[model samples]
Target chain A: MQVHELRLPLRAEDIRKLKEGDKVLLSGIIYTARDQAHKKLIELIEKGVDLPFKLRETAIFYCGPSPKAEGKVCGAIGPTTSSRMDGLTLPLLQQGLKVIIGKGERSAECERQIREHGAVYLTAIGGISAVLARTIVSCETYLWEELGAEAVYRMELDRLPCYVGIVGD
Target chain B: MRYLKAEDIQKALTQAICQISYESDPKAVERMRTAHEQSNHELERDVLGAILENNELAAIDNIPLCQDTGCTVIIAEMGRELVIEGATLQEIADRAAAEAQGKCPLRASISYDPLFRRKNSGNNSPAIVHIRQVEGKRLKLKIAQKGGGAENMSFLMMLSPATPLEKIKEQIVQRIVESGSRACPPLVVGIGIGGNFERCALLAKEALFEELGRKHPDEHYAALEQEILSMINKCGKGAQGMGGGLTALAVHVLHEACHIASLPIAVNLQCHAHRHVDIEL
Candidate 1:
């Protein structure tokens, strides 16, 4: 598998270079969202309400942050199973979410959406959470703070590693 | 009558919960290491290695091996001869689990209500505890921090007793194929056969507590385990579904006698990080 180092808010055009099985170490800002956050975001989009953050040219990590240990920026952060959010992905992709990082496979419809919408799906190692957590440079609640761990977390990543699970055509 | 203090049981459960969150279960680690060493494929090999490395890191740093601290499951075999002093076993277990979850920095994975509120319980209390009365004076408990990903993929089926061995094999293989990487491969497949519906499901979960790579005592069941393991590996859904050798580390079959016309089967998948502890008091 090929290895690539790309910084995030990855441009849609740059995603084409990443094919399935390629490895990537991403460094930059990405937002965290699990199924709950996805639902809320979709509801906001459906109501024509402006989201607090822009979705275009952005990397969204499927994750829920634990309460941070005393000095660490985050705690035990890792990819949740991505297929849980499969149905909610299309609208975000349409809004120009360029990179989606999670663990495990996606549904056929989710795959088709990524292929058509100029987005890529990246898979991180499931359960190897602490190693992944160390890559977080900083983390803060970006939205839906009342949702606790399910809230959207704005994080700066320093060489977060993952494999390409699907590619945008 | 031998006296077993309620406080002692609570203490044991609390320590076991905190211990498993960081320390790697020895047998599971051994099998994972073996899979890592034996794999010929690069990506599969690397994924296995990363899992092993993460175990070491989690232990050293005193952090959870996985972010999902998991819903607590405890199976306690209570000795009939033993008398408890302070509280019921279930109440003690609940309190112990809550204490560990709140103190150890483990995530609160349990929702207070499954449907309506979906509010986090915050302390991960009210463990799924199964208590059985036994003859001995000593108490034994198996505690598992079962994560949502693997638990969600577990299944059960009521097959016609007429269904043969090959068909049963087919059903199990198909289930794993559907699970793919979502259940997190390099899994431990626990098969519970011949019991009634609920009993079968509980048997499957109990089977997961078996040591990885240990063969069943009954020769016939041992053979069944081997056959299923081969079929899963042959499906080519490798570590994390990358397509290679060793999709599952082992398959464990635990069976009990059932009615003449009924055959029930259940499959419980435990992911690479098998976090559980056995306690004797």
Candidate 2:
């Protein structure tokens, strides 16, 4: 596997260069969203209201960090199963979600949409939460405090390692 | 009659809870290392290497090994001869589990109920405790912080008693292979081959507590375990389903006699990050 260091806010051209089995160490910003957050975010999108973060030319990690300790920026954070969000994903990619990072495979519908929208899917090793969290430089809850861990968190990551699972034509 | 304090059980349970949260069982660690060494895929190797490193870092940094610290599962084997003072075991376990949940601040994976009000119960309390009577005076507790991912892939099928053994095994291998990266290969799979509906599921879970890859004592079941392991590994799911030589670290089987008309089987899966511990009080 060839290792590549890539800065996030992945664009159409940058995503095209990635292929399956490539090891990517990503740095820059990402928004964390899980089950509940996906629902709320999509709801806002349908209502034509402002989203907590821009969805274009960006990446969203399907994970929730553990509660940070008193002095820590974040806790153990790992990719969740992407298939769970299959229903909520196409809209985001349509709005220009260039990259989706999570563990496991996506449903056929999501995979088709990923290719259609020129998006890339990446998977980090699941359960290695603490190791992955070390890559995060900072984390702040961006929206949905009521959802607690499921709330969207804006995270600035440095060299977060992941493997490309799917890439567009 | 000898009496043991509920506090003692609480204290022991508290320690066991934390031990699993921060560190995986040593045998589990050893199996992972072997998987890492054996896999041919570099992607698989790389991920396994990171997992092994994560184990060490989690201990050093005092953070949980996984964000999904999982729902607390405790199987308590109580001796018939021993007497308990203070609260019931369930109550003791709940309090101890709550205290540990606060200390580790493990995610509140549990909800108030399964449906309707799907709300986080906050402190990961009300541990799913299973108790049974055994022969010895010692109380044995098998605790696992089982995450939802692999457990979601666990399966139960009531195959026809008249069905051939080969077909039953094939069905299991097929479903598990279909799980792909979802169940978090390389996994430690616990399989229960016989018993009633619920008992079969319980047997599969109890089988997980058995020493990681230890074979069944019965030669027939041992051979079955080996066969299943080889077949599953040969599927090329490898570590994290990256495709390689290893998929499951171990496949443990436990079988019991079932009703003449029934043949129920349950497969309980544990991800590579199994935070499991055994405590004797």
Candidate 3:
């Protein structure tokens, strides 16, 4: 149970070193998405449209935070179940996505894809959303506001806590 | 005949929603504290401690307990002699939920339609309300915020009258094991036994609102609850499915007599957050 503090946009080598059950304190910028946002991103990829952000050395967090209160960075931002997004995992990994942060176990296919792509899956404690929100320094909706909280957001996180659930190849 | 103001009911419900969202129920907190103290695994202890701290932050900061504020489910036990002025109970519940959504700013998780138009309702309204007639003049309300993660893990099983209770127990344990970290443990397992399909499911969900550590009134059912709780904890999935000694804090079973030939069971999983509140008017 070693603790590793890593900045985002991590290289493949960086992700491959992570093993299941290891603790991580992730800082730097990450993108937030859920089922809807994942669908949209995949649609864009199929249509040959440019993505909103670069996928290289990047991680996508599965979350839909509550509305923020005054003077708060974000509201109760925690991970959603990752299995729901398993269908999209391989496609996103193929596009150079390096890490996925969420709760729950990934499907076998998703895990295989992660290992092949040298990516990792991490789990944030579910239901402790308010405590997790304290680590997020800032957030801005980057795409799909019409989806409400399901919209993709660019979040600047400082020491966001997570546990490695799957290690890369 | 006693009369209750619809506005008063609405006001009470709105306040209840806010309280349930922000303050972890005292019984739930107590169970978490006990689990934290008794857990043999360090990871399980840490997870319980973090959950307890999150509850404190939510209460002090006046924010939601979980990111998924969940769809509002309201159960109202209305007295036969009581008359609600100004609005129907369903109307009052919906308005109250909407009001709470605005004030507490609960995440709007409801989609108006199930299929084609998956649009956010925005107000978290059109709450799922169930009304039952009781004997007295008091109006009793139990509200719970049912999050998608655990709600999605709910299961329904139909068995023959000859099916043994052991088989039923196996099914219940299987559901929890399959849910793993997805539903977020330590969970409160709510089991509904011996009702029609839909009624059975509702019973399971209603069972979740029972106070933690409270047993079923029936001795047989109470023992069954204890048996199931121990079996689930042994599965070794632990807190957050990270592998530990405490997978479930408690198991609650609610049963009603059904047709002689039918046996149906439903399991509703509730996460450690356990967001529910009760009010009487």
Candidate 4:
């Protein structure tokens, strides 16, 4: 029942400093991606293409948000199932993507990769989209806009509440 | 029997889609509230409280509950003797979904091809419709906006007929506990047993629409539901796997007769804000 207060834009080292059951208010830029984006990112890796953004020291949020309402920051932001991104963790980590935030457990292989890369996984409350969305400051589609909700969105957040769930255990 | 028009179906589907997006079923809300009150872990309790509050905010704001508005599922129970005068039921359902997606401004989650083009269906159309005939003069429509977080966590076990009920409960509970925060804990566990592999899976999904915390009329199955609910809660998977008292608010089982050699079991896990509505017309 113990609780802790934490802040972000957190680093890989920051995440490693924490353990399981740490409550944090995350702020900064969280990129949104889902199954389609994961597939595309993996495909690009296969094709040996360069990524648009750096992955290291950055938190990759597993989310496919709704289109932002007029003059609003974001709409109904919530985490997607993280397990679906299991296959791409190693490749993404190899590319320096450090903090992985999503819901659910990591695959055995993903756990190994996370430990090796010194990464952390956070589970946000699912179905609490509106509450989650309130933390955002601005939103804009970055890539794969055609993918609709699956499109990669660059979101600026302000004290977005999240908790570290699984830390390689 | 009232011959419902396509427009009526369309309007109903649209309204239902929006209604369920943010609002939790009263039944589910009540169960979650009770479970949260009884929970032990503070983290799990917090998550449960947040979800319950989210439901209220969404209802007031009319916002989509989760970003993943989810694939639309429409279950229609028709009177055996009733007949529609205009379009086919399936067509109307699809049209309604498409119209709702556009007008409600719901996200377009459907894909044109699962493996190929993977293009957005654009309007969240072509809902998964299951129709059944019953001895009634009224038509019933039940709609649920199922989220992918929990949908992906669902599992099916094709057990040997010799598999004991204990083993069945073990598998279901293990998966649900292991699922933890992934499927959005403080969940509603829907179990479908006895049918063939596919039928059993469908039944599991179908069982999700049932009123939360309510048991089957059959005395035996009702006890099984309680047993499963008790076991899952004892795991301490809690609300969001943060460790709490009640991991699941309810465990609903829907079964059917199966082959003598097989005992197929399907587990359909639903998140805390289980949104669904039914109307009889």
Candidate 5:
């Protein structure tokens, strides 16, 4: 029921007080990645390829939004079901990604990774596409343009609403 | 013979798909609003708000309600005397479905070889089409864009004919409680009774396309629907399972004659975003 304000490059301690149902308003950067980008990112990490951005102290949002029409930063962006990314979360956690923003329940392995890595998973209200879209102050494609909606789009978000749905505690 | 052109049916199908994705049936929307009003818990309230907001955005922006636009499933009824001309009915339906998926760019959820090398079919093709012949000449098509989440929660029960009606009701409500937020509660519960196993399950799923809160013409079945809805909502599953108000907005029960020894029951859970459209051509 408590709504906390979060800043970019959030620390583990900052998210430690949160539980599975606490809501928060987050401001700062988030990177978008869906199934394809996740596959590629994990593969790159396995092959020791350099990542475009530092995974440490960053929140990854699982989303695949519609194309930008007109001057909008993105179209109808919302958190996707999180379970699909269970395979990638552990490695990303090991790589220092501290927060995962998505919808739905996480796998036990993902929760274990979060606990071990001092990370958390936050849930944005699912189906609030336009509300989430309005939080995007800016967005740019960082990779995998040909993947269409699955392409990674780095976002600068302001006062985005999310609930800490899974905690290390 | 009552004649219907293939083109008319195809166009109607396409329009039905697009319309349902954004504009939910009025009855379903009304029931959702009522569920929101009755709910007391914050989490359930929040999920309801998000769902309502999604509906608004989808309509205002002409976007599909959910990214998973779902595989094309058409329930078509034609009069016994009606004739479909110009192309095979199935072929026209398939082509229309492909066109709808592409133009709408609905998520390509369908995969080829669902068992082994599951390759994306690219166009969400090979729609699930059900046809039945009736006595009237008028053609009716009902469409429901079923998401994977709720579809995965569907279950069938081979209940003994002697099983108490109360127990059957308990199973349906318990299934929703177990599903919690997984099937996206404040769901629409569809129950099929009396048919054979597979047919019963299909009947339950098809029943979901009916207007929310609408009851069966059969008085006994309608009473059961009301009872189930009240019981399920009282279970505290609430919207998206965060707790508080109604777990389900409606309970639709459909029944058919069956073998004397068997009472096959099926439950098909449908999320609150229940997208469906109807066309009479």
Candidate 6:
């Protein structure tokens, strides 16, 4: 249960160091995606198309933020349930994705994949979007704008709070 | 007889939506604060503390409480003696929902179609409005912005009359345990017993509108609520399901007469970010 400050594009060493229940303050760039974006990402993988961003050593946060209010860099941003993305987890991990952040427990198979791939699953407090948004310094839609809040966002975070829910055995 | 203009209802709803989205109900906040104070585990206390802090930031910054902004659920109790001046209530609600999208930082969570199209409704219109007529000349509206995560975990069961109360308790606890961290505990559990299938579900949802920490009117039901709350907390799901002693903040039960030989139950869970508002006219 150590508290670690981690930067994104996480190294395999960083992933291995995390244990379940450890607190983390994540910083740097993280990609955002939800169920819809996962579906599309999977489709692109199946078609042998290159993704918009590199998956290796990168972290993806499962979230769909509310619309930004006046002068705010981002709107309320919080984690959605991770189980909803279980079906897409293995494929993403196999692509060398290293960190997954969301709320709730993942499937047994997803946990196994995390261990096998040397990845980690972190959880943000569900429903605490406003607090989470304060940590986001900037956000830009990188893809799938038509999906609105479900679009893939390239976010710059500073000390975004989370916990290590699942770590590679 | 009193006459309330339909436009007034629309304006009131718009204001209510913004208020509920930006600031959590004070009673719900106090209950969470109490849960924080009662938690023995360090992680549980930290989690509960974060929830309270998040709510405060939302109020100060004037932002939607959560990213899921939720589907607007409006329950209206209209007095029979009150006459609506202009538009239909449904139309007024829709207009208000659209106005909310324009004025607030709310996400457009509702889909235009549930099936093939699966398109976002854009403005978050077409609120789920439930209207009932009452005796007085005043109109009361209770608005809840129901997040998708917790709403997805709601459950319903039909048990035989011969089934013991213990069985019902077991089912309730089992459902909450299975829901785990997904429904976002420390939660408020709403239990509806006795109504038919659909009615039971509605009763369960309606029960969620009850003020946190308020007991059921019936002494028996109040005792049952306490028992169920204890049972759920014992599951060790804790805050954010990270293993703690405060999984549930409260359990509310609303029961009605049921058909012979049938006992129906519905469980609706609300997340820690209980965003709801009430308006009276």
Please state the CAPRI-style docking class of candidate 5.
acceptable
Q: What docking tier does model 3 reach? A: high
| DockQ of candidate 1, scored on C-alphas against the true complex (2 decimals) | 0.73
For candidate 2, the lDDT comes to 0.87
List ranges where model 4 is wrong by over 4 Å: A1-13, A42-50, A166-169
TM-score (0 to 1) for chain A, all models? Answer: 0.96, 0.96, 0.96, 0.89, 0.95, 0.96
Predicted candidate 6 versus true structure: per-residue lDDT over B1-281, tens digit per residue: 99999988899899998888877778878877887887678888888899999888888877678888888898899999999999888889888988998788588888899999888988898899999899999899989989998999999999998988898899899989899999998898989999798888888988889988797889999999999999998999888898888888889999989999889999999988888877898
Quote the positional error of residue B50 for candidate 3 in Å.
Answer: 1.3
Model 2 bad stretches (over 4 Å): none
- Residue pairs clashing, model 3: A9-A57
Who is ahead in lDDT, 2 or 3? 3
Q: Candidate 5 lDDT, tens digit per residue, B134-166? A: 997888877777876677777999989888889
Chain B, candidate 4: TM?
0.94
| Number of clashing pairs per prediction, in order | 0, 0, 1, 2, 0, 0
Expressed as tens digits, the lDDT of each residue in A1-169 for candidate 4 is 3344444445545666677777767777768778889889878888989888777745788988876555556777888878888887788888877677787777888888887777777777778877877777888899988888888888887777678766643
lDDT of 6 by residue, A1-169 (tens): 5799998878878878887889999998889999899999999999999887888846899998888888989988999999999888988887889888999998998888888888888999988888898899998888999998888999999999999988885
Clashes by residue pair, model 2: none
Say which candidate scores most in lDDT. Answer: 6
The residue pairs that clash in candidate 5, if any, are: none
| lDDT minimum window of 10 residues, candidate 6 chain B | B31-40
- Which residue segments of model 5 deviate by more than 4 Å? A32-40, A48-50, A66-76, A84-88, A107-109, A137-156
TM-score of each: 0.97, 0.98, 0.98, 0.92, 0.89, 0.98
- Chain A of model 6 scored by TM-score: 0.96
Q: What is the lDDT of residue A66 in candidate 4?
A: 70
Q: How well is each residue in A82-158 modelled by candidate 1, as lDDT tens digits?
A: 99999999999878788899989888989999889878899998888778877889999999887777889999999
Instruction: Using DockQ as the measure, name the better of candidate 3 and candidate 6.
Output: 6
Alpha-carbon RMSD, each predicted model: 1.3, 1.2, 1.2, 2.5, 2.8, 1.2
Better of 4 and 5 by DockQ: 4
